[model samples]
Target: MGGSSDVSRRRFLQNAALSGAAAVSGVGIARRADAEGAGGGAGQAVDPRSTEASGRVMNPIVPDFAGEYGGKVPEFQVPKRPMGKTGLQVSILGMGGFHLGSAAGQKEVTEMVAKALDHGINFFDNAWEYHKGMSEEFVGTALKGKRDQAIVMTKVCTHGRKKDVAMQQLEESLKRLQTDHLDVWQVHEVIYYNDPDKIYAPDGVLEALTAAKQQGKVRFVGFTGHKNPLIHLDMLNRGFAFDTVQMPINAFDPSYRSFEREVLPVAVQKGMAVFSMKSMSGSGEPIVHGALTPTEALSYAMTVPGVSTTISGMDSMEVLDQNLMILANFKPLGEADMNALREHGKQFCDGRYELFKSSLKYDGDLGRQQHQFPTAEEVPA
Candidate 1:
């Protein structure tokens, strides 16, 4: 087992302290049952306090894992939604494929994949260049016989007007994933306004993607960017329609660089599936900035409207189980819960983490491309 880091230790102590306080104040934390069945319309009002008054939150409805893991473990379910316009239903919790390639060994990767499947997660995300393709390889192997049971999404990054290169990447990905086609194939790391034109230009990547879809090599089409929402919106607003979009949508995001206010509403209006990333602020920068705890940050993201799912990177079963508990026990946050979470993270959003707002590290690939094709003087119509 991995040793607890200082941050983990701190989080445990804080949770224990908070639990004790709740006990003394008579504000009981909901057990594991009530949360599963408390369904209301989107944006429905929920009383946060009543959650405690309602007694234990219900445990997630776990599937039978007797022969698989040699025993039973708690199961968690996040809600599900169809990929916009594709009509493909996917879990609200997505498994990020980043660390699956980089940090985890083959056995660990297999176990992680098994655990996620054992739970209700069916949205598996990966990228072509992640761990130089090891991530996709592992996921492909893990989902070998179960391909029909899940939605596999992956991305490919290629340079200007290179449809051939893009197609090649997709073919390689298909080979590694051991699948005939992808459910969703995205143009990865899109960070600037002019990106769409370059992608959709004659002999550009979008042509390859369109070809893939027509040939049944892929199903839904989408894009992911970490830097700016304007860039994302600009890309989507251009002529071609996207089925889904992925961007950062945590508490620190709203006050400083909010995709929720600027881009998400548009996606919702367009009926595109909105997917959230960096809910835990990936590099732990939110924690360094004294923003909300990991759990609180995740809660805030889940509460945002139009978010079909939030992708969290879980490297261990403990992390996975904790997130499962949160999702399974989720009750729509009331005004007070939302206010408290927002207030707690307000100071950290004062542009201090603006590193996340710039594509500096992506300078070579995304930044250079942006320089080449700056957003035209006229805004995208």
Candidate 2:
């Protein structure tokens, strides 16, 4: 466990970064990775902490996965960065909201949130639809007296509904999060093809975003989606101003239809706080399938230049401790190393690891119902 042996793991990562796995034709195992992790599916209440990491569907690219796999939790402070043009300094890492509901109970959520705050995490991501409002409730209870210490954000799931629906959801989100005002309020799951049109229509959710800010109910407003890059682009091109944008970012993203490649630069150019999610391929498929180590996946996502914070889900203390340990020994991957990792990810770039884009698997049932799309069971991917 000494830092002296860093070279072996680093070298192994280098090899994996440059590797293409088993070539594009050898994509069968990738499918199986999707299947094994697909049981609970996405947008569900699966505890992210329970993902088993040691034995995987495939052998690792290298056998030197010793040090990064498990390590002592460090008490050092996690780093912070500027939140785009918002002028607020937030932790480079954020605590995802959904997993809070999936945690064992209120005690676990309390511990995880407390630990996250102690480690300098100030940005918390949540949505109105997550865990049937349980996620927001847990985050609310955990942050009772310490509200001022965190930058709380939750999405209003209007989903093509009228402005009134957005407003109602906002009020409920406030009640569930136990806050009178939110640091950030976002339009959740702008995934459907006509989302932009619907949101920009007369008396749409965009108006709600404006009214929320004007009424001092929210400080900033933005939107989030993990679908096509074009959908995000469409949202950006529309007339309304957005304070932030959230999307999936990972090593595998650069090789495929990439939000980093297409939308990230635009959001950065617009001076929006860019929050990254799905750093571990939405459900740790790459790690569980031995495609990339957790360190490599997280490092790549956080290392992306324009990212304000990388939001990762931790349903148990173990996952949180692992993340803390990674941050303690953190170092950015160089541009060349990033490219190598992207090249390595080309093998699984077929959308197996990042199922949010590939299938309707990640879409929430509410969103599906709103969009008139199929259920999670119908399209399990």
Candidate 3:
């Protein structure tokens, strides 16, 4: 199993710690029990893509996460979408980098990447800081013979450092990813209050982005953050033309310090592709707490307006399979369903479930070190 699976379970445990509930995953993540009796009650394992042998629809979920999925869904490919004006096609399900690094080994990472590609998941998300370059290395090695089929995206973690630092990190990322150019290179984790000011400063990382594009080292440029929407707005309003922007997009976001409410429209208005992360409330907090089901959370993020794709953390083959099934059969939830989910998520709007915004749990150690803040261990949520 991937170590990220372990970490995810731990985070789920911690989140469920608040409610004393059991854990879930991309697979173990429990879905809603159909009011019309979809399957084995609320926690029944049903194939998400299509009907199973019992001629049952995959609507509900199984809380018994220890069991393997004994269901089968129809084979289908994930859909592609336009990535803003970059004119690049991106997958609705992008593979996350941190968990790619956390997989057991290169072989496991290769398997996951291959499965994703076979299903049309071309957008691979990564970072220069993930696993100290191990994530980039695994992705590089995995895409060795299939680089042309993937839209690889990685982030530079200057964390308010100079443009020189960003440029150096880009070089390292290219070397580690074994690529001549990055399809999308972004400014990683622009969460700090003064991050925008620092990035726009003379000789800042934005200069590195412009240089990378000018030098043919990267095809597109953007920024990402999971903290406040105000911070993302600050980045957007900085007068620089970004091709893409990423943020946390989930049901709870609408009720809390909502990036969906505050930033989604602005980016769409600016004609920028908006990539979503932390669809399951950064750690399946709501799922474990029995507020939102796994499918509901994933479906909601995938259907959020103006979102190009929902970037998910799939560390294991089981997780990958589950997410693929969800994507394969994905239909945009109706306006009423979407609004109902928003109302359902209102209870978690206090930042308890979304700890990435409210706490230090999802804060990277490298970012904290660069910012001179205490480690997550020192001051955890």
- Can you give the TM-score per candidate against the true fold? 0.75, 0.85, 0.83
- Model 3 CA RMSD to the hidden true structure, in angstroms: 9.9
Top lDDT hit: 2
lDDT of 1: 0.62
* Range of the 10 consecutive residues with the lowest summed lDDT in candidate 1: 33-42
* Residue 220 C-alpha lDDT in model 2: 93
lDDT of 2 by residue, 31-90 (tens): 111111112354232221233322332223223222343344657788899999999998
Off by over 4 Å in 1: 1-73, 288-290, 359-381
Candidate 3 structure quality by residue, lDDT tens digits, 109-128: 99989988888899889898
Candidate 1 residue pairs in clash (backbone atoms < 3 Å): 30-57, 31-56, 31-57, 32-57, 32-58, 32-59, 33-57, 33-58, 34-58
Cα deviation at 54, candidate 1, in Å, is 33
What C-alpha RMSD separates each model from the true structure?
12.1, 7.0, 9.9
The 0-to-1 C-alpha lDDT of every candidate, in the order given, reads 0.62, 0.75, 0.73
Candidate 2 residue spans exceeding 4 A from truth? 1-40, 43-71, 379-381
| Position 84, candidate 1: lDDT | 62
